[model samples]
Each structure stands twice: as structure tokens, then as C-alpha cells.
Target: MRITRIETFLVPPRWLFVRIETDNGIVGWGEPVVEGRSETVRTAVEQLAELLLGKDPLRIEDHWQVMTKGSFYRGGPILASAVSGLDQALWDIAGKHLGVPVHQLLGGHVRDRIRMYGWVGGDEPAEIADSICAQLDVGLTAVKMNASGRMHPIGSVGEIDGVVERVAAARDVLGPHRDVAVDFHGRFTLANARRVAPLLEPLRPFFIEEPVVPENSHLIGQLTRSTSIPVATGERLYSRQEFLPVLQAGIAVAQPDLSHAGGITEVRKIASLAEIFDVQLAPHCPLGPLALAACLQVGFATPNYLIQEQSIGIHYNQGAEVLDYVLDKTPLKFVNGHIERLTGPGLGIEIDEQAVRSADKNGHAWRSPLWRHDDGSYAEW
Candidate 1:
């Protein structure tokens, strides 16, 4: 079927959804957003649509190559995220046309159920033990928390002790069975990242995320060698070429976001590349329903898929929750901390068009906070 039209909606709580309409009455949904830059990504998707209209929606790979390389400049948050949403829609259409799930087309599923993790702490963490307990009460066996908030390049031992205390509290609440992962959120410099990386080992975190930013790969290599805990990053990385250096640098887990990393077409390629290096997949998805659905499609098909991130009750989505705009919220239910395989065609979940249209006008221009130190120095948030 030929793609007839592309539509976008800036939905509530900072999400942008794209819907691609085809001639055969089959439509596909995608979430193409960069957390705070929803409008910019929407414009990028609109420009990319110039190349996709009237093209056969089923030629996913050809379209992907063209959408990516057709432009002289490509592969950043805006361009890749735009391509990512459109690619998800194309794959969704392809799966529906064949009357099979996306994973079935991608060599079928390797596992019956995929494990999922939830977020506990917000940008600035507080009541972490209570948050951990809340997630555990909801049947999540694993939860992730930000390691610290607005840390200085060189901080005091008291600052270091606070991070240690947060993880330690989460560990105590989760006990030995449940896993806890700490995210440094790329706020720490190489020196602090190296010094604090191994300290979390005693707490037995599942993995430490973005110990240092992607720019500091050499430091990551050093930190990985110093600690036994698995080092996971790549949420900010936009392409496979960007992922190669970090993979070669020796990360134990690759956390590509389906909404940002060129969607199913490129993330599948990224997953394959990571497999070659014995790396695991823990897709970074903290967006709305469409993004989570896209990640599940890839997670189900990928062999090395470790755990999927979900924003079911994340802090940022205060008024608009993940299930609000979804027509079939059942696919997101967790059973003993794992999501059972999706059996429906395409992304295996339906979108509530009525709700989407209604919420479109209520969309917020959501932006993350910029923090400053006590002395008015800029701090990472």
C-alpha cells in the first residue's frame, strides 16, 4: 500500500506522535520525539515526509536507507528521531499487511516474555526507599534511580556519601532478589566517574548507566576495566556508527532508544552489531505508548535483549500517563515483572485516535530543568 498522508500530534506531558495513513485503510503509529524538543523533532519529521509520501510503505529498508542517506546531513537527535518515528510506522504497516506481529517477521520471538524495569527517583531524588517500595508493590522486580543530582566536577566526600546512601537504601528495599540499577545521567566528569564507578559495586547494582558521557569513551574504557558491574550507555547515541566506538570500548550493555536511534530498522541493526560484541540490549524508552510498543517489537525479536524501560508511572508524565492514550493498555501489563509476548499484528497495540485528537491541543511544551550549584555555578540536571 502506498503511503497517502502523514500526521503528527503534540500530545500531553511532552510527547509527539506520528500517524501514517496508507491507501488501503491501514494506518500505523509512531512516537518520534526527543524528550524536550518535541516541536523541533516534529518539524524534522515533516521535512522527511517529503521523501516518503506516495512511496510503498512496505519497502522499509529502502525507505530507511533513503530517509537516512537521502539527506546530505544526517544522524543526530532531530534527523534520526524523525526517521525513527517514520520507520516505526512503516514497520507497523508491513506487519499489519502480512497479518503477523513485527517480531514474527523479524525471525519470530526468541523468548516468551520480556523483562521490564521502572524508574524510582526523579531528576533530584528524594524518598528513594519509598519510591523503590512503590515500584516493588506494583510487581516490578527491578527499578532504576538517578545516582545523584547536579553534582560538581569535583565534589566533597559528603556528596559521594549521599550517592552511596541512595543506592544502599534502594538495595535494602529491593532485597537481594530484586535488581537496582543506578544512572549517573552523564553529569559526572571523567575523574568523578572513575572514582565513583567501582564504589557502587558493593551495592550490587544491575548496571551503572552513562557513568560518563559518550564523548569520554576513553574514560569509560578505564571505568569498565576497574569495575565488575556492567556498564550501560548509548541512549544519547543516534546511529550504529556512533555506537561502534563505545561498543569497541567495551560496554556490557547498549541502551539504544527506539524513539531516538533510527527506530526499528536501525536499532535492529544496532542490536545485531552489539550481539557481535557479546553486549546486551536494554532499550531506553521513557516516552509514551507508541515508543514503548516499538521497543517491545524489537525487544521480542532480539536475542540479547536484557530488559526494557517503560514510563508507565514515571515522574515526568504527571498528568498524561502511558496508558491514557493507548487503546489497548493490556499489552503493557506486567506479570511477575515481565511483559508477555504481544500476539496482535504490527506493533501489537492500538492507538485511541479520539483520545489522541483530544489531547493534541492540550500538549505542553515540556522542557527539562537546568540546575545551578549553591554558588551559582551551572550544574548538570
Candidate 2:
């Protein structure tokens, strides 16, 4: 069916949702946001709509190649995120039209249930213990926490010890049974990453995320060689080309965001590329329902899939939660630390259209927290 109209809704708690409608009255939904840059991504999606209007929604592959490469200046977070949401909507429409799930179209299910992890707030030892306990109460077997917040570029030895102590506290609470993943958040420099890696190795964190920013990805190989802990990154990477260097860096896990990294179309290919290196695929999804649904679709079909990240009670969801705008929470209900395979057609979850449209009326302009050191030098958050 021909695409009739494409609509975008800027929802609260920093999210942008895209809806694609066809001549046959079938509609598909997707989440296309870059955390704080929802309005910018929405504008990018609006511009990309010119290329997709009146085109057949079923031609997913062709449209993907064009939307991603047609523009000479392409493949940034904004452009790729716009294409990501559109590609998700197209896949959602394709699955619904065929009366099957996206994973079924991708190949068949490899696992009956996909393991998921929750994000715990980065606070003091007591607060960290409380948050980890809370997540465990809800049946989460694995939880991730930020190692440190607003770290200095060259932190002192005491600060390094504090960072390790924070993680060690979580390990103590988890009791060597449940998994604990530590997020470096790209705040640590190469030297800091190296210094902390050996200390954290003793605790055996699930993985160290973004030890440094993507710009310093060449150093990832050195860091990976130094530490036995797995290295995972790529929420900012936008395409297969961007992922090639990181995979070649000997990283053990590749974390591509379904909403940021060209959606299912490119992420599925990214998973294949990582598979060649024997790396695991753990999607970085901390957004709305449609994005998580799209991530699960890929996780179900991908062979090297490791785990999925969902923002159910993540600190980012202030006024809005994951299930608030979703009509079918059954597809997302966590049980025994894993989400059972969704049998519904199209991304396997239904979006509440009325809630979305109403939220868009008073859309939000959310921005990431900007931090600074004591001397006013800028610091990563």
C-alpha cells in the first residue's frame, strides 16, 4: 500500500514517536529520538518525509538505502535517527500486512524469551543498595549503574577508589548471582579507563560501557586487551560504517540503539557484522514503547543477541512511563527476568494513539543535564 501521511508526536520525558499511514488504512508506529534533541530529529524526519511520501511502505530495503544515502550530507545522529523511526514503522507495517511478527519475517525465533536489564540510579552506597533491591524485587536478574557522575578528566586516586567502591557495593548486594553492568558514560579518559579496568576486573562487571567517547574508539582495542571485562559501546554510532572500526577494535559486545542507529534495518546488519567477530549484540534502548518493541523484534531473530535494555522505571521517565502510552502491556511485562516472545503482528505492541496525540499538543523540549567541575571546566554527564 502507498504511504499516505507521516505524522510525528513529541511526547514527554524526552521522546519522539513517528506514525506512518498507508492508503489501505494500516498504520505503523516507531520511536525516533536522540534523547535531548527530539525537536531537531522531528524536523529531520519531516524533511526526509519528502522522499517517502506516496511511496510504497512495503519497499523497506529500497527506502532505507535511499533515505540513508540519498542525501550527500547523511548518516549523523539526527538523520539516521529519523531514518531509524521510519524504517521501524515500515517494518511494523510489513509485519501487520502479512499477519505475522517482525521476528518471524526476519527468520524465526531463536529463543523463546529475551533477557532484559534495568537501570539503577547512581547515588550513594545506601541509595544504590536500595535501588538494586527494588529492581530485584521486580524480577530483574541484571541491573546497570553509572560508575560515577561528573568525573574530573584526571581524577585522583581517592576518586578512583570511590568509583570501584560504588560498583563493589552493588556486587555485594547482588551476591555474585545477579549480574551487574557498569556504565562509564564516556566521562573517563583513556588513562582513567585503564586504571579502573583492573580494579573492576576483580568484581567481574558484566561489561564496561563507553569507557571513552566514540571519537576515541581506536583506543578501545588497547583497553579491551588490558582488561578481561567485556567492552560495549555504540549508542551514538549511526551506521554500519561507523560500527566497523569498533568491531575491529576487539570489543566483546556491540550495543546499538534501535532508535539512533538506523533502526532495525541497519542494526540487524550491525548484529551480523558483530557476529563475524564473535561479539554479542545488546541493544541500547532507554526510550519509549515502540523503540523497545523494535529492539525485541531484532533480539528475537538475532543469533548473537546478548541482552536487551528497557526503561521501565528508569530515572528518565518522570511524567511518562513506558506502559503509560502502550495499549498492550502484555508484550512488555517482565517475568522471571525475561520477556516472553511477543506473538502479535507488527512490532508486537500497540501504541495508544489518543494518548500520543494528546501528549503532542503540549510537547516537551527535554535536554540532558549539563555538568561542570568545581573550577567551571565542562564535564560529561
Candidate 3:
């Protein structure tokens, strides 16, 4: 069957969903968004649709190669994210056509269930304990929290102490059996990260995510070597090529977002490359249902897969949630901190087209928060 129509929806709480239709009536859905820049990515998706219409829906690899390199200028968040959603849709179609799950087509299950982690707002140390406890109540054994909010460029002793205090709070709540991952969120300099990572060592965090932003990746090896904490990054990174240097920098975990890093097609390759380095795949997905579904497909087939990030009750969701647009939440239900392998074809979870269409009419314009230091200088948020 040939692809007949490609439609994009600008949904609430900052998500862009793409729906691909084929002549024979099978439809596949994907989340192709760059979070705050969903509109720009939506335009990119519409432009990419030009190449997909009237083509064979099953020519995934060929379409991927062409969509990525078809343009004179290539490879950025918008283009890669655009290709990412379309790629997911193609894979979904292929899986449905073959009457198997996407992971089965990828090779098959490496494990029966996938471990998942939820987000806890750690910007304020006082709220961390309660937030983590809430996640625990919902059966999540692990949770990720931001290490700091607006950190000083060269963190003061107080700022450093606050970071330790926040993690200590999470550790106190988690106890020894549960896990806590600290997200540096690229808010720290190399020196700041180096200074603080060792302090968190005693708490034994599952990992310190994005210790330094993607731009300063060259310096990550320094931070990784100086501290015993496992370093994880790649949410901002968009391809295997972009991830190679960071992987070479000795990160212990690769957190590529399936929605941003060329979807399942390229992230699977990134996981393979990271495997050679003995790194684990903890896909960075704090988005919507389709993105989480796509990540799960990859996690099931990948041997080195560690944990999955899902945005069920994340603070980012203002007017909508992960389960809001899905018809059946059974495939996404958490059982003792893990989601059982999805058995349905394609992405496994069926999306609510009516809900999605209704939400699009009142689309959101979400932007990342901008921060400034006490002295009025720009700061990472």
C-alpha cells in the first residue's frame, strides 16, 4: 500500500503528533516534536511529507536515507526530529502489515519487561522527598530529578551544598533498594560538575545525566574520569555520528531521545555503537505516548537497554498527560516498576484519534524557560 496522507497535530502541553495514512486504510502515529519548538518541527514534518506521499509505506530504510540526505543542508534538531516521527510511522506501518510488534521486527525481545523511571521535580530540595514518594506510591522503583535549578557558573559552596542536599533527600526517600538518577540538566560547568559529582558518590546515584551540555562534550571525559558516578547524556544529541564523540568520552549511559535522535532506526544504531563501549541505553523520553511507545520498542530488542524514561505525571504536562490520548492504557501500565513487553502490533498502544483531533484545535505554544543569574547574566535553565 502507498502512503496517501501525512497530517500533523499541534496538541496541548507542548507535543506534536504525526499521523500517516496509507491507501489500504492502515494508519500509523508518531510523536515528532522538539518539545518547546513543536511548531517549527511541525513545519519541518509538513515539508518532509512532500517526499513521503505516494511512496511505498514499507520502504523504511530507503525513505530514512533519502529524508536525511535528500536535502542539500542536513542534520539539525528540526530536520532530524521531522525524520524521526516519519520513521516511527513507517516502522509502525511495517509492523502492522507483518502482524508483529516493532521490536519483533527489530529482532525480538531481549527481556520480558522493560524497567521504567519517572520524573520528580528536584529544583526545590524540600519538595523532592514528597515527589519521589508519590512516584513510589505508583510503583516506580526509580526516579530522575534535576540536580539544581539555576546554578552558579562556578558554583558557590552553598550551591554545591544544595545539590548534595537535594540528592540526599531523594536517597533518604528511596532508601537502598530503590534508585535515584540525578539530571545535571547541563546547568553546571565542567568544574562545577567535577566538584559536585564526587559529593553524590556516597549517595550512589544510578547515574548523573547530562553532567555538562552537549556543546561541551569534549570536556565530559574529564568529568567522567574525575568522579565515580556513571555519566549519561545524548538527549540533545540527534544522531549516531553526534553520539560517537560522547560515547568515546567514556559516558556510562547513552540517553538518546527516540523522538529527537532519528527515531528507532538511528537510535538502534546508536545503541549498537554504545554497546561496543560497554555503555547502557536509557532512552531519554519525557514526552508523550507515541514517543514513549517508540522507546519501548527499541528497549525490548536492545540487549544493553537499562531503563526507560516516561512522562506520566511530569511537571511539564499542564493540560494533557501521556495516557490522555491513548485508547487503552493497559500496554503502558506499570507493574512493580516495569512495563511488560507490548504484544500488540506496531507501536503496540492504540492512540485516540478523536482525542488527538480535539486537542489540536486548541494547540499550545510552549517554550523552554529562560533563566538569568542574580547579576543579570544569562544562565542555563
lDDT of 1 by residue, 127-183 (tens): 887888788888999999998888989868987878888888888888999999899
Give me the runs in candidate 2 sitting further than 4 Å from their true place.
Answer: none
Clashing pairs in 1: none
In candidate 2 the C-alpha lDDT for residue 362 amounts to 93
Q: Estimate each model's TM-score.
A: 0.98, 0.99, 0.99
Clashes within 3 Å, all models in order: 0, 0, 0
Give the higher-lDDT candidate: 1 or 3.
Answer: 3
Q: Which stretches of candidate 3 lie over 4 Å from their true place?
A: none
Clash pairs, candidate 3, are none
What order do you get sorting by lDDT, best first? 3, 2, 1
Most accurate candidate by lDDT:
3
Local distance difference test scores for all models: 0.90, 0.93, 0.94
Tens-digit per-residue lDDT, 209-251, candidate 3: 9988889999999988898889999999999999999889899
